[model samples]
Target chain A: MPTRTPMEVSIAVAKAVQQADVDVIAAYPITPQTHIVEHLSELVANGELQAHFMNVESEHSAISAMVGAAAAGASTFTATSSQGLALMHEILFIAASLRLPIVMVVANRALSGPISIWNDHSDIMAERDIGWIQVFCETGQEAYDAILHAFRVVRDPNVVLPMVVNIDGFNLTHVIEPIYLFEQEELGDYLPEHRQSLKLDIDHPITMGPVGIPEVYTEAKKQVEDALINSKQVILAAWQEFGRRFGRAYAPIETYRVEDAQILLMTMGVISRTAMGAVDRLRDAGKPVGLIRCRLWRPFPLPEFREAVRQASIIAVIDRHISLGAHSGPVGQEVRSALYTLPNRPQVFDFVLGLGGRDVTVHDFLEIVELAEQYATQGPPESEYTLIGLREV
Target chain B: MAEKVEKRAIIGWRNLALGCAILEPGSSMHLLTGTWRLQRPVVDPEKCNQCGLCHIYCPDLAMTKTAAGTYEPDLNYCKGCGICAEECPKDAITLVEEKE
Candidate 1:
């Protein structure tokens, strides 16, 4: 049996990577994400983990080094947030297109302009189309378990694409939580050795990342798209196997009290815990309300998402970042797009909140539910999305 | 050489499953670049002192050393970059424009 211990979320993440026995860890330190790589470097220094710990100068070099290491048949892992992730944007696409099974943990943080080191979806949301399988975790345990599950999904022979496990910046990474840590012996049977047939070797030299002219560029992109879309199967299989082994079941769309509700408040990350409280309060008051937390972000889980919201009369999507001038927030736009074809689709109200680590309380969620009800009765909001809990100008 | 052509066809994206972008190791050898040349490098055997400068400088690894120690360019895979001709210590290599 795995031991349940109290540890900081960042420490738990590092321990999970250690158990995964990654061959290389190349990362640059950035706020919120610093503790993850710091613990990993300490593990390498203490010889607790037998791996190459590269203290690269910049995020670009960190990702670049991981790309080379992964290409050379190494089970590679890296952690970054905000600007660090933005710095690696160019290489992130290459890592996916090359089909390198590199796993990354993004301590989701707000992007800079005013220079704030706080939690937000701006970081990962910007890189959504980079073609990596993205999963958001609501807690430290999910973050740790997702790391192990990410490797299994990415390195599968049928699905050799990169993956990113996103955890809210200071909210989850800096918090201490009781998590069940898997022993290496137990994980051995669950996750076998990483085997890649297309690795680089001197004896069998191969040219990778060759120049693709106009003739083959579109086809190359199509191949990558198809691979990313098809990886959903492997992801589902890995999660199912993980549940069977650990007895903690997870799904792409995790619901809370949505069985018989007319109003559904949808959210991602740690904020869902708060939303659940609001749902309980509303239910106690004889209001039909529930919650839907999105776990899978990439390949969108369209069918699962459509089914989750099919019965609700109104859905209030709480977004951590805005899409500027779009009809709704990023998540809201995606939800609306998924339900566009349905004959009797529920009205989705976009609620933008929690930018730059702003505290979102259960009371705030209750207010959002009220606003969503008003919108459903009348028409939708006049603007694209309502900025919730904004200070008076 | 013919086997490489067949291997390229087998490994092409059209034949592989969607999103499988990996190529076989040393697959570049199968990509014949000789036809890409506007000018071909010809070596003057008498001027060649067997210094192997052409072999050391060829960008495509097209130059091969013979049993007798003379460096020869494999025109089939050579793009005729003229790097070997420019770097030749004995001026043994000259680039000749191909006839249209």
Candidate 2:
């Protein structure tokens, strides 16, 4: 029987990793992500988990070390937050391109300029094209489940791409929730004994990441791109199987109360729950508003997104990070691009809010919905995005 | 034991080893660096000393000691860097511009 325990999300994440029986974990601690690696180290020290827990010098070294470990056919894992993820930026591409199935859990946080250690999507937004399978979790339970599903999808024979499980820093990462932690035997055959087909073997004597001279550079990249797109099948299958066994269903796009709603509010990460509450209140108030949460970010899940917004006439896209010079936020930009080809696409209203861990409540989401409806009459704003909670001088 | 590895041509991306990893060692030998040479080194066996300085100084290991104890460069793999000519104690090697 699975044990449901009320534990800190980070600790629960560590327990999930322990359950997966990861062979190596090389991580550098950063706030919001510290508890995760910290508990993993404790598990290793206490003889609870038989794995090599490496306290790496930096996130760069952490990811680099994972690449080496994964290439050596060892199941590897690592966790990091904002600046740490940014530090691993260079090696991130290398890990994905080299096709090492190293799983990483990113406690989503704001990137620094004024040096804030708070929650936001800036760090991951900066790495939108890293070619890794990226997913966002709305709750601690989802975050914990995502870790197990990540190992299954990435280590699959046809999908040997690295994966990133993004959980909102401080919001979801530091929260204490009742999570159903499964025993190893309960996960029977979910993740089999990992044996990577292509790995660094002294007996075989093969080189990895060899110079892809001009002759095969494009094709080499094409291969990884195809692998990432193709991996969606395995990702969905893992989620389906997990739900069948564990009873918590997940999808690329999760919808709530869109039956006859004419307006939809789209969100990602922890804010989705607040948006769901806002949808409930709005429905009670006779406003035809619904909610759509993007659970999968990479490979973009175009078909599901389009189908989710099929009946809605307008969509209010909530983005946590401003794309600097771009007219809209990164998530908003992607939504617009994805919906551009449709003859009857929904009018997407973009909002930039909750940066550097500012409090976002159901009230804030309600106002966003009102503003989206208000702007729908005006046929797109001149500024393209409404910056929520920005104080005026 | 080190196995005998042969040089092979690059394959298409579909057939390329995972991540384009080179499975065959010593594949660099097929590159033919001799065509990169702007000048060629010629050895004069008559410079009189059998000192092996030139053999030690050739960066590419292109110089080989003949049975007579004189070093001769295999131009097929030599890029004519002239390090052997400069290091020869008796000036037994000369650099000559390659013929067009």
Candidate 3:
């Protein structure tokens, strides 16, 4: 139809979530991501949407409100950015293990020391292991599609896990692109009604958050793990169904021009588009190169990753968040672990780049490839973490 | 008077959709055999200061204090979610599964 802006994408997301019948809205406002909450607030204020808008005092409370609502048998949604997301750390893990299907939109922004209001994965990175079904979006349409599929994944009978659909803070959150909007009737047909056994009830109340001992403690964690691991099948089925309706399919790891590549570039977030451009340039010049976009970050599709990297000899992983003095960057460490556990693995390496939305140009992409080619023959460097996009002293 | 609706997903409709309800509606024992017998929160009278962390954190609000300053749990309301035992700063509570 017509062109759309990042704000339009978020509006579409809110509307679609509304169409999907989200019963509760909990969120805090911050730059870059501020438009999402601001617009959603207008919809609620104008009586365009019917849901409890928990204008929580903090990101922590925003998350907690959703947690409470989800337990109350409401399909809940929330949004946040940067340090606001960091505030929700404690409850994010709780939401996943408790198996309450709360869907959230995180306008990915950088954590501050220097006060950045730009696009970066630092916000989502800090929460890598919080056990939510994480989806990274490259475009506005992807952002809209991710929210719909996330609802299906998060609420699946087997995979009652919360989900976070993240788009790069200002880059995607503030930018504009046309979205393939869904009709309310079609959205309802695709997403079923909120259906969880009333985990909360006043008449016959049951405890929501409880303490566990050694005996049941392991089982609690085990149940979550089993649910998360088992969710793989259900997640794929939902995505397939989503594609059937939305006309776009998202894989855990999507490949670009890697059929017979000499080097592979692995990354996430909006930067993948730039890396793909590098892939094309390298390919045109007869330098076999491919790029893999990690769309699903948590409950990492290990099998698919293992399969994707099996053919490549040298792989370079670019991380948007740093572990700080750690062996590898967050996503890099995850990639290494996944590949190491696989029977057929590649010589995977990683670098920390674009923290606080630092610009990572095509030249930087070449530097990553140079390192990958070096590792292809010499093996992984002695030290794991390499800081890229930093000016040498 | 409270009205109730059957939880279709929790009690899967596939079987019902296939025209097999064994009994129409209330003919079967839906009150699960041992759900009530499992892990009741036991309070340690000697250690309990009755600070009420247990009462507040209990998801179901199963704990309440009497006018005499003694805390007690309403077994009818406590599904043994264990938040009480876990949140009790003094380790004043324990949960053990019971048969009766």
Q: Interface Cα RMSD per model, in Å?
A: 4.1, 1.3, 12.7
RMSD of each: 5.1, 3.8, 10.2
Decide which is better by TM-score, 1 or 2.
2
Tens-place lDDT digits, model 3, residues A129-226: 78788888887888887887888777777677888989888777776776767667657567867788546776755555554434345556666666
* Per-residue error (Å), model 3, residue A127: 1.7
lDDT of 1 at A175: 93
Model 1 B-chain TM: 0.79
Cα lDDT for residue A319, model 2? 95
* Full candidate order by lDDT, most accurate first: 2, 1, 3
In DockQ, how does model 2 score against the reference complex? 0.55
Candidate 2, position A149, lDDT? 93
Residue A14 of model 3, lDDT score: 72
- Give lDDT tens digits, candidate 2, residues A190-283: 9867889989889998888877666578878888898999999999999999899878999999999998889999999999998899999999
For all the predictions, what are the DockQ values? 0.19, 0.55, 0.04
Candidate 1 residues lying further than 4 Å off, grouped into runs, are A1-3, B1-100
